[model samples]
Target: MAVTLADYEKVVGPEVMDEIRTLAGYVRHKSLQNINSTPVGGGVAEILTRMIPLLRELGVDATWDVIKGNEAFYAVTKAFHNALHGHPETITPKMLEVFRENTAMNLEEMKLEGDVLFIHDPQPAGLIDKKPTIGRQWIWRCHIDVSNPDPAVWEFLRPWVERYDAAVFSMPDFAREMPIPQFRIAPSIDPLSDKNRDLEPEVVRGVLERFGIDPERPVLTQISRFDRLKDPLGVIESYRMVRRHCDCQLVLAGGGADDDPEGAEVLREVEEAAAKDPDIHVLLLPPFSDLEINALVRGSTIVFQKSIREGFGLTVSEGLWKGKPVIGGAVGGIRLQIINGVTGFLIHSPEGAANRAVELLSNPELCRKLGENGQRYVRENFLITRHVKDYLLLMLALDHPGERVVRLAGI
Candidate 1:
């Protein structure tokens, strides 16, 4: 979707887009290469799908590259991901050997000749080992929440992480005490994209109908991959609790990412848990189902993100932007997005989530109030325009480290 900066004026105001253009001048004509593991599965790919085109529109020669890996490679990376979220997992010597082998293969194949190379996530983190040979500015963008990461995993990744000239994290607390400068650039949503943009009433109704859902009744939905960290089974339990208090339907929608092998297993677990419940709708949406997802959030009474350990929780922002109160876990970026009863309530368990859902379903006026607050909060803080502006600033900081001030007109 060609979402130009000019197309965002109605949602973000012309002044904001104008300021972004002014900032873009500083990094104009510079080549930036972004590398990650997947092309269409997770949030990193989703963000780059929109970002690279916008960066090019602002005169930067921006390109995105995806690393190649087999099922074994992805399985090892998935384990490392779970451990990074503080889950206890055995990191064996064989796993480290596989990770190193894959990283070396990618480094040899990837053409790293950009003025600024932005390596994202741990999958390609070991690419930093070639920094001295390439001799260019490298910024590592970590989109995971490593607040209490497994020490062994962190120590394993630390040497490669420290090799970057700078690092980018979704939250400040996710940063470690590395020697390089760390930038906190929260992931953002494209308001004009197919996922967050407005849909016709018929389109919304069609989506609900396609899923055999009733629009007149209260609907609770959570959109994320069928992963353990997302706590889909926990969401089902919470839905049951709320069902006892009120007659509402629950929709657990999302498919497995291409790089995550545990998705089918997790989906089976959720299906088994939701068996015999006619009101619970378990949808296995395929990739590029943004319009359906948009309709799901837009047509719902409320949204739930109940993650055990979250990175940035961009879905919360998407739901809030669509004017729905989101009940999320009190963790990671959820804390930044939900203001605990102001924008939305933060819950620690399924009981707390069910209680909050009861309160919201019972009070339409309060739900509207919180939804309005959340929409405005996301517009002010979490939209793609602001995220692009932050990246522009980070580019400046990387280019000139010691300067007290940066002029957007000068590189």
Candidate 2:
């Protein structure tokens, strides 16, 4: 079910909705072109899928486009992704060549019709090379943590990044010393979306039964891609440590991205890690398994996001939105989502996660309190209504770059 502008007004008040309408009125027909690598399987695509329609309903012409690149393009971009997230990876000259070749091809094929082009991540960053001729306000929205980026990959992508009118990052620390002004726009979740909506008790029960999840024992879930950086194996180790103390089940389920060639390999690694544990359930769901994901989170006793590296852990926000206290890694955007002991515990190692999980499991009152606080926190700060307002303000600011002084004589 697509969220409409009225749905937003219902969550937030009509006054804020009116303000959005007023801001959007300034750029009623100004097109917003969002270009990313894939239209499914990742947070970037998931966010834009929900955001674009709401923007249009607010009177801005918003459209999403995907950049078409072959396997080589994705392979190079995947390595670039690791490098940007502070992972040590060698970017060969051939990889650079692949990046440029894919960019050149996408530049020729993608339509540059929108007045403002928002290129998402390194996958479509080089699309700005055509901005010189396309003549539009281009903004690069960097969703990864570039705090400790690999110098070579940064050098390659930074030139294209500097060409943008502005840049948007998820966290303040993720921002680098770029010449262009940067804005801190945190990612948000939609409470009313299929992935976070209120579900019937029977629905949750049925989903659990279908997956053979024993509700009698506590279920610990880590919902994310089966990628190495997500640390599914580490999550299993943590769960195993916790299992020694309590009877619990572990669910490691996620889908693959078209741009990520290494997902299947990582999935196999996780499978091998859990081969001996009959209590471990590994599911390779389709990219848009919103209702199923929601049910899994609802059925779990606790949710975990043990990522070694993360752009922003949207799954953390999703779990928190469901009032499930998430145990996330103390890295990247997970720090912003899990507020230590308030929303959930942020840990550095498997031992730390196991310790926290054991503590939470023993104290039901503390778990309930943290979960309640987390739900409210996410509702107020991380909902899509707030995200829409921020983007609308950015659009207004970009439209009137020199309108600092509004004349009040008429008023």
Least accurate 10 contiguous residues by lDDT in model 1: 402-411
Clashing residue pairs found in predicted model 1: none
lDDT for model 2, please. Answer: 0.87
Q: lDDT for model 1, on a 0 to 1 scale? A: 0.90
Cα lDDT tens digits, model 1, 268-312, are: 899999889988999999878999999999999999999988878
Clash count (model 2, backbone only)? 0
lDDT of 2 by residue, 230-264 (tens): 99989999999999998889999887766566888
- TM-score against native, each model: 0.92, 0.89
Candidate 1, residue 140: Cα displacement in angstroms equals 0.6
Residue 107, model 1: Cα distance from true site in angstroms: 3.3
